[model samples]
Target: MGLLFGSFLNVVIARVPAGESIVHPRSRCPRCGHQLAWYENIPVLSWLALRARCSSCGLPISWRYPLIELLTALLFLACQRRFGWTPELVAALVLVLLLVPLSFIDLEHWILPHELTWPGIAAGVVLSWPMGWGRVQDAIIGAVVGFLVFWGMEWLGEKIFKKEALGAGDKDLLALIGAFLTWKPLLAVIFLSSLQGAVVGSLLLLVRGRAGPAPDPEPGPESTPAPPVGPEPVDTGGEEKKAEDEEEEEDDWEPGPTSIPFGPWLSLAALEVMLLGPLLREVLPVPLDMLFAGAR
Candidate 1:
């Protein structure tokens, strides 16, 4: 069932980015625009049978579809194993669904749509009552703390760097996740996310060479190129125009993709916290249980 659900999720993943309604239109091949038949749409099995190619166009499908389906299935099974049929199980499942979409979306676009995050927070808070796990107060406080702390970090980053440091969506994402788990596990999520980000970033840097600087935006087709630097009467002949251009370019440039799909990182962090954060609490040097017990 989870695998099947994940297949549908692939449609969501592809369509949501294009500002399309995920529920209205059915799935189709991107290359050929062929609407998939029910048989051809059967999650992992269909992918395997088709040999990861579209039935209509013979286009090689991305392996990500099957992988995501399989991953989601395993995640669902793991939650069921741990939590059984409790409301916590439902909450965990919701997290998995939302995270799957958010993770991939952020990876592709570096944006976490309010369409996901805001609704997630609302749903998380609403469902907390049925789960009877955390109090409403805790969820509210978590959201507040999560947003404010991250927003402060963003402000500080911008002030220091003289550039926007974090996307507004990132702050919203933290708030949304924190609303569900409250402050304690949210902290765990942030810590784990930071650790993961650093490790992944370092590995990528190593693999891809020191990150290349961002490219300048491509000029529109109709735009004309500026003439090469020539003798402009400047402050003095002592100041070389060529040297000034180089310095200006260096100062003005921003790094390319300093933003990794942070939504995905946050999603993974939330997943870890949801599943095993309390266990980690037991192992922490300072007893996190003592700190969060009152909040619970």
Candidate 2:
């Protein structure tokens, strides 16, 4: 079941950002436009069977396909082990579903769509009902507080620092996390996300000289030009801001070489708190363990 859902998630990751329907067109080779048959879409086995090439056009398939399938399966197993057969298991699984795609989408596009985050926030609160009103209340507070925390940070960055520090979508994503895990562990979530992101980002900066993907360089005069289209789609960084209103504000910011996406780091921290909080608390020193005192 995890593998099957993971397969569908690949479709979500590919189509959602492009503003395309996930179900309308069958899966196709992005490189060649060859439609994939049912057999060709059979998760990890099919990838191995086809030797990681499209059967029709022989375009090399991305390893992400199998990796996501395996990752989902393993995480599902971990959730089952941690939560047993309790109602919380369902919540954990749902959180996993939302996080997996959001993480990948952010890594590739650096935008967590409101489409996913909004629905996920509602789902988190709804799922908590099975555990009673206390859980539901926590979920609600978590969502609001999560959004406010990031929004405050964003406000500070813009007003005091004179730069946009966080992606607009990040508040929504953090709210989605808060809704699922409740407000208690939010500090730990922020701490872990920031610490891990900083460490990894610094390493990436050292190794690649850039912490995140840079925009494609502008075309040169010698570059072959395409026939002029009326207007090309401008990437709005996943925010649904009005183009005319945001034009000037958008021009004020560009992703610097050291910029990195925070959504994946947030997702990773949430997962750790969800599945391994107790172990982590025990493993860390007493001083550090204080951070996870309220962890579930």
Clashes of 1: 0
lDDT of candidates 1 onward, in order: 0.69, 0.83
Write model 2 residue lDDT over 1-296, tens digit each, in one string: 78998998999898998889989799999988888888989989999999999888888999999999889989999999999999999999999999999999888876798888999999999999999999999999999999999999989877875556788889999999999999988999999998888787767756765566553234233543221110112222343323233222453334444567889999999999999999989999999898888787
Clashes of 2: 0
- For each candidate in turn, give its C-alpha RMSD to the true structure in angstroms: 8.1, 7.3
lDDT tens string, model 1, 1-296? 78987887787788876789988767788899999888988879889999999888899999999998998999899889768998778877887888898788766655678888888888778767775544667778878888998899878865764445566688888998877777766666776777786567545645653222222344334433322221111122232223233222423333343234456777887877677656656766676555433222
Residue 286 C-alpha lDDT in model 2: 99
Residue 15 lDDT in candidate 2: 91
lDDT score of residue 73 within candidate 1: 95
